[model samples]
Target: MPRFALLLAAGLLACAAQAQATSFVMTTDALAGASVGVSESTSDLSSSFGDDKIVLAARDDAASFVASDGAIRGARLEAALRHIRERAPQLDADDRQLARAILVL
Candidate 1:
């Protein structure tokens, strides 16, 4: 009985950890739709395309946002810029502006 209780406690802990690690959401608009999530670490981007989701790890100074339906190409490009902004303060205003535009889209 003690062993069984230990197993049950371990299982519950695993389930709770899994839940805390993964987060996702769906968004839709008249023009397009997107589904986005953070990976198990919340440090990477997880994008779903139709039924498929891709996980992309980000740099230490970066944050990732996955768009609906696995539209990751654009999002990744934008993420790169954001990374620069967060990690490389030497970047000029022009660079920051460009990154902002990519993120806004």
Candidate 2:
């Protein structure tokens, strides 16, 4: 019984050590990827939304729209969509996605 208990404890310690090592590696990799993603996403968002007149016009309104609690105010969204449809009708996007992109910009 004593020998069995000793082996079990040894096994548990080894597993715990392995878990800690694995978590450290995962955390390190996640941090590295997140840092790289931040810059890339910013640049991507800029290229996608920054140059657009309609999106630029809607940035402040979108910021305000998101700042408001639940119950979306669609006026700003509609206005932006209208402008997009009138000017660059080729671009396709849904309201939620456009709102998110506006927030990101």
The most accurate candidate by lDDT is 2
C-alpha lDDT of residue 59 in model 2: 71
TM-score of each: 0.24, 0.41
The model with the greatest TM-score is 2
Candidate 1's C-alpha runs over 4 A off are 24-105
Clashes in predicted model 1: 4
Task: Write candidate 2's Cα lDDT for 1-105 as tens digits.
Answer: 999999999999999999999999999999888556445544555675577776777776766665674246566666875765565454455554455566676
Model 1 Cα lDDT, one tens digit per residue, 16-103: 8876655322223421331112121112211111111111223221212223322333545455556545654543434323323233
lDDT of each: 0.37, 0.66
